[model samples]
Target: MSTRRYPHSSVSPEEFHKWLSTLICVLNSVYFVLNMITLQKLGLGTMQLAVATFAGFCLYKSSNGFYRPWHSYALLISLTINILLSIAVMDLVAGATYWGLALPFWYYSLFGLRKGFIFSAIIVLSAAMVIFFRTDTQVFMPYRTIFNFTLVYCSIWLVCHIYEVQRQKTSEFLHSLALQDDLTNLKNRHALKADFQAFQHSFESMHMLIIDIDHFKNINDKYGHDIGDSVLIKVADALMQSIHTKEIYRLGGEEFVILFKNINDKEAFRQAEKVRKAVELGIFFSHNEPIKLTVSIGISSLRPEHEFTDFLRAADQKLYQAKREGRNRVCA
Candidate 1:
């Protein structure tokens, strides 16, 4: 299988799900053989065999690069059913009942917070009901068994819930760090590529605008790097204020990118002009000294066969043309 890491973590959810399912498959397969051959429990063994087969099939498909989200649900649901069936057949003393405790962690890891909590609750309540009603009170005190089981289950559930919460918070923070510009607080180049892939198929036509601060090196030379940073921040603010629908991205240094959707070339040029005038007229201050700034914008329309880089290259070429003609003009 591929070993691609997610932006937030070393292992992607698909990889985790594959490994978890593989483990379950092996365990269930071993249990099935044991039950069928040694324990002489045909019904439970058959159920285990079925769950193992399903898990194995999912693994095979995943290895072949045919993974799907429903495959995860199917495997988890089948395993849960098999566990419940085993509990019902052998009762609480069979040792399968303890597996319910681990289900919370698995569910939380696979389904995430909301669905994980839901599935965990279902399994916990279902297993509790089976233990409460099925236990022999004379041999094993039903109340004590239920009480201890519930207490431990709840403790594990709480821990899993807290861990999942923290995991989600960390994942979001890392994702933001990966995709956001630290200085301007705008989306970065990686975010631009990601967003392009997300929305490329949704819109019929798209346009890109590459905006560059005119003579930005001169600004840093005359003032300072700190003042240049201040200028970039102010320019980002102006871009945010000027555009309503499109998202603005800082593509490192003094360059920014904006994506426009469902607009013609003329409209895209008009929007770029609007942004240019906004930056030109705005007053930027660094250490209480007002600095005048102008931005050159390049506009490019998405072509049928264009990839993200090609689209970006087209706009970048136009940006160079804008800089060649004049510093404060817009080119398409």
Candidate 2:
């Protein structure tokens, strides 16, 4: 196997984002209480009910699956409508403009730039509409609030864009890591295992061929360790060249396993013979000399009741038989 590292599989980042939603919900509850203290200041009924209802929705989202990015956007829409309806038309024309700034932080961290920006625009425009219609308060309200809101919005937009770009790079890096063989840059045993799973349900009618190079240790001893490494690379190239979308696996040292998904018994036998002949036809030329190479192959049909390991063991036994009988041939 090639020496590249493949990270083990794990849960997706989206699956772990629920805690963020819950934290936001708790914050909403706190904000709701503070807003309620302004009840006599604003009036008794409408604005207070509107804020409390939104807090209740946040709590519901926390307890349910509503914390996802799409749901957060939907909740923002609902809150916008509620705000329009509850605030006195004259009071809305005044200077209470905050729901816009607050809602984006709830969802933006979890999404990419285009989507996060769109969501922010939606909330901001919704607030602007209410603020446009509401207060004429000259006390706390000024044209600078619009400028400040826009500044904060642009800052958040840049941060989210950078974050998404980094995440995408990391995902691609992980994908490349998965396909690499840890020792040689060849495909590893894990790749073969994944292809096998693809076939178990869809292509139950297929064959397995397992190949092991003959007298490899003798070469390692005859040549130096560096030469031995070169021989392994040449052998891996030969196998890869001969196989057809067949998964090539380095099972350590001189043993390699190739699996061709969705081929019948006779076709599989033909394919195995082709590989055996291609590998054994000549020597692997490295440096100025030709180093003769031959591989022994064991072929087996996958039966309905046989587990993957069982089939592999059967193929392995045939491989040993080929070595015992004389190498450079295939056996079933």
Candidate 3:
């Protein structure tokens, strides 16, 4: 078993799934043992034991982020096994069919909306078929049993559906908060780092530009912070309009970063110049007076031996050079 910790917190869905898988393994093992000892139903018992062992191994591997490629399919397979077992044991065990009731919750949590609903339907239908066809099972009020089962299963499905919808909304809200800048509505530095780190190994070549506004402090000092904010907003708008790609980040204050994917050094420098010119040409008005704004940009392309920090530092150095040489220009 691998001991490596995956990139998921204790509260994350992956961690929750891991714990759930572990629980399933233990519970299934116990059920299998009990069925084997008392009922001696060799087929059901053996199948349950097999499922238990599979769940256990998958849990171990997935928790440590090892061999996780089959994890999703494993979930579906485990649920199918349990559903079959539940139907098969309905006649032998008292209230065995009730075991299928929890299927909705697990499906929704593990597979998400569409697949969850589908699995839930399959479980419900399988249980119903067993009840309808296997009339040899000793039970009273057959119509009432069918009615109540259908109603209860439908209720469970509806509840799980609503819960998953809300969970998805909350997840999306949190994800946006983590990645988006509150002021400019652009992605923030945290988002930039996360994205770059995840995709750095995959991208063969890329370009980065660090942009800074010229004498931004003077604008804040001369016109007040309100006007300074307006300047930043306008500048952000200009940059957004100039770039065709979504890999733009607001690095706080007056600094912004743009990442160009699969672009060479010459093309990167050309894009930086184009953005600088766009910002210079953009017109902004403050207190009925037109203000001309310009930005200095430093461009750097990924090198064969560059780490993320090295690439960023190269861009920063070039930005400094641009500022020193003269504002309103691009440096490489």
Candidate 4:
């Protein structure tokens, strides 16, 4: 909704899914062929064929732009099952046990921290159990096998876990940077659009107030840009204190927007008037010298057929009307 691209990867998620699905299909198909020709393991080859078919289907859907959440889930689950089954039927040494070690990375990348942890834990524990119980004691000591397998599995899991945690933190930090106003420390226009999308379907009635500082250029021209920035910061602080709702955003230099959900026209205007009065009366300082400021607010109500840009345009038109009539009043 925010339109923030993934900071860490060049490829989109859909593209990544398609690529991964294709790789899975190809690798499984190769494995299936090898099992049939070289290994002569009928059951194992059949299972590989089944997994390859499923992965191929997933790839087909993704390439046609029909991907879903369950596609990833189903693929991962099937792969895990096939790996576990191979180890169970063929024993630890002969059966693709090494494949199990990569499960944690796959799970963490696809499912994220919590679900990844649960899924990885289940696979690791299940594999450990199979090795501990079914491993041939004459060829390999059960405890030693279990110990080596688990130690390696845990080390991989820990690395995946740490990487996922850091990835999440970096993502959150980048998202905030994308949506936040650097100067005023308020939500920016991108954030406002994102919030509008979230509220549009859930609320039957919503209102927007677009507030502009009157003759903002005059302040910058008279006192300088630094002083003007200080005034803007003070105004932002005033709006934060005066508005009961937390849906305030700065729509770039000298303009701000506030959103109200499930509110009627009358209450919306009342809230806008209150904000205007607060800004008018509040003391703003530049180098400890008091400066006076006023904001003109324009109000618009959400219409069912209106998209975010349309909604914003309507309020912006009202804002222009307010500016034409006078500089310090509310217009609807």
Leading candidate by lDDT: 4
Q: Tens digits of per-residue lDDT for model 4 on 1-332?
A: 25434524334556666777888889889988988998798898898899899998988998998988798898989899888887877755564789899899888777778988999899988998887777555777778877888899999999999998898888877788889898998899989988888888998899999999999998999889999999999999999999877788999889999999998999999999999999999887778688899999999999999999999999999999999998899998
Better candidate by TM-score, 2 or 3: 3
| TM values, all candidates | 0.93, 0.71, 0.88, 0.93
Q: By descending TM-score, how would the candidates be arranged? A: 4, 1, 3, 2
Ranking according to lDDT, highest score first: 4, 1, 3, 2
lDDT of 3 by residue, 45-154 (tens): 78778877888887888777874635746765765667566665546346776767788887787677787888888878877776666565466555667678888988
- Model 3 residue 147 lDDT score: 74
Return the lDDT, model 4, position 248: 89
Q: State the displacement of the C-alpha of residue 54, model 1, in Å, after optimal TM-score superposition.
A: 1.7
lDDT: worst 10-residue window of model 1: 1-10
What global local distance difference test value does model 1 have? 0.86
Tell me the TM-score of model 4: 0.93
Cα lDDT tens digits, model 1, 1-332, are 01123532246667877798799889999999999999899999998999888888888888888889899898899989888888777855668888888899888887788998999899888988887777554697767877888899999999999988888789777777888899999989988898888778989989999999999998899899999999999999999999896468999899999999898988998999999999999998877788999999888898888899999999999999999997899999
Better of 3 and 4 by TM-score: 4
lDDT of 4: 0.87
Clashing residue pairs in all predictions, respectively, total: 0, 19, 0, 0
TM-score-superior candidate, 1 or 2:
1
